[model samples]
Target: MSTNPRGPNAIDRHVGSRVRLRRQLLNMSQEKLGEELGVTFQQVQKYERGANRIGAGRLWTLARVLDVPVSFFYEGVSETLNQPGFAEGDQTPIIDDFIQSADGVQLAQAFARIRDSKVRRRILELVRTLAAEEAEAQAAESEQA
Candidate 1:
């Protein structure tokens, strides 16, 4: 064995925090969520603490149970949006704001309904392109300020 110890970093903690927050907002108990996910409450605790990695399949199941997209865990989590990342405590408020948005919830639902991998990739690409364009526009506006 390589004796490598697995541990979550700042980003993982951020994702976990988002998951916990959404669960709370939906008035879900960790035990209830675990029952839905076929996991133990302890496992749910691990996920909420970022003590274990959530696999893609498990994440998908979680999204369904949470009534959100897998991407919902990552919203408001970009490095640019959070200075010093989650470690500096800057992203929590942003994540909370994102979770409260109707548009964000709609987007999450739309993302969850996309089954085709290629279509999902295309959607991500399109969103990235749109975000880039928006950023450019913002930059232009700032320059004129």
Candidate 2:
């Protein structure tokens, strides 16, 4: 394994992503997080963007500030590791990726807030119908093309 410090490794990126996800879930801004860690917001941005590697001491501090266990940063990381019968580290962490996105997070939060089962079902049905219609439209467009 190349120990290049010019850029963050995949594991560093994954850990950084987890940090960003947890911070966003709490609606904490980069500035606030940086303030708590005694670093600039730009450093936090670099961390989130996987442009810089975070040290163990800083990671421990982040876990404490974020009110999460250190293990939280390693969740879903198995998908990124080399596995047999497949390209090394080629697996997609689809579910985790979605939960980490702003739209996905917002949708999940909204869905969870809906206490009515019927409402949730109706929302799901509405989304399914919209997706189906969009798919059909795209197919028709391709056929026309």
Candidate 3:
């Protein structure tokens, strides 16, 4: 891969896009996230623009506040490292799309409102089962193709 100091790394840009997408999905403004993180909005903007590196501590805090795994930012990034910028061939992190939907936000809010541990566990189990079934179905389809 060609190294250019002025150009942003594809991984960095992708991760920044994911972070910005998630922040928007949660209806969070950069100012709000900055307030929560005890930083200026400009700093948050820099992070989102990939102009500044996000530190591990800040990433952890961002994950906690955003209700996602730290891996969420890096998901699908490996395949695009050599690309100059994110391209259509690279996987568009599905979580970003899912969480950006209105239904997704509602579902997340509803889940958060559920105070019972047992119910939460059951919900998690049900989601897992559904996801597994969907994966199996997709695999079967691909096999037939």
Candidates' RMSD to native: 11.6, 3.4, 9.1
TM per candidate comes to 0.53, 0.81, 0.53
Off by over 4 Å in 3: 1-8, 82-145
Against the reference, the lDDT scores of all candidates come to 0.78, 0.88, 0.80
Candidate 3 lDDT over residue span 1-145, tens digit each? 9778766666667777778878877789899999999999999888887877787999999999889999999976765364566677544446545654557767887899999999999999999999999999999999999
**lDDT over C-alpha atoms for residue 27 of model 3:** 83
* Better candidate by TM-score, 2 or 3: 2
Query: Which stretches of model 2 miss by more than 4 angstroms?
Result: 1-6, 85-92
lDDT of 3: 0.80
Model 2, 1-145: lDDT tens per residue? 9777677888888888899989988999999999999999999999987788999999999999999999999886666554455664553766667876888888988899999999999999999999999999999999999
Candidate 1's residue-wise lDDT over 1-145, tens digit each? 5533576765666677677878876778889999999999999888877778788899899899999988988876675346643576555566555654556655777798999999999999999999999999999999999
Best by TM-score: 2
| lDDT at position 139, candidate 3 | 100
